[model samples]
Target: MAYSLDGVLVFGLLFVCTCAYFRKVPRLKAWLLSGSGVWGVFYKAAVIGTRLHAAVAISCIVMAFYVLFIK
Candidate 1:
């Protein structure tokens, strides 16, 4: 199955977020330290107007919180 660009982007973000979680780093830190948060980065990419990134980001964020507080 071929993945669309949006799908690839979302998965890549999720993988990085997961790795960061395991390493105990802040979620989306690379993006935030680069001068934009995940939302801002994805917003700029949203010229295509797909919600995939935002949805995945929110999921990753929630997972990060869960790992930090519960796990």
Candidate 2:
């Protein structure tokens, strides 16, 4: 198996999202909890031109929502 640049980029975005969620970086955490963050993730996906990354981004965004609302 081989790793692609798209995978790495998606992983990196997810990592940053996770870190921001965990660290509770004031502004970033706030953004992640809002619709804008979801939109931002989708926008990034569009720019990256990968459906897989979009799915990952959606999951990450959903996780952020879960952390903020349910957890």
Candidate 3:
């Protein structure tokens, strides 16, 4: 339940990418944003820290929602 740094960074990245999208950034950039979020989660998961894994898992779920429904 505490937030990890990767989670915070991923959230900030998503927010920035969303703003960029609103500013008319290309679809490629948005996809890269989402891709990097997934990469970050996978990296955290592979490293094997329980709290970090939990944070990454939560980020993945939230990002999935945004990717599926928001965009």
Provide the overall lDDT of each model, using Cα atoms, as 2-decimal numbers: 0.49, 0.52, 0.50
Question: Which ten-residue region of model 2 has the weakest summed lDDT?
Answer: 42-51
Q: After superposition, how far is residue 59 of candidate 3 from its true place, in Å?
A: 0.3
The parts of candidate 2 lying over 4 Å away from their true place are 25-71
TM-score, candidate number 1: 0.32
Candidate 1 C-alpha lDDT tens digits along 1-71: 12665455546565554443433335544444343565554434432223354665776676567557864
> Which candidate tops lDDT?
2
| TM-score of every model versus the real structure | 0.32, 0.32, 0.33
* Clash totals for all candidate models: 0, 0, 0
Cα lDDT of model 3 by residue, 1-71, tens digit: 12875566566555544444433446543444343555554333333333354665576677777657874
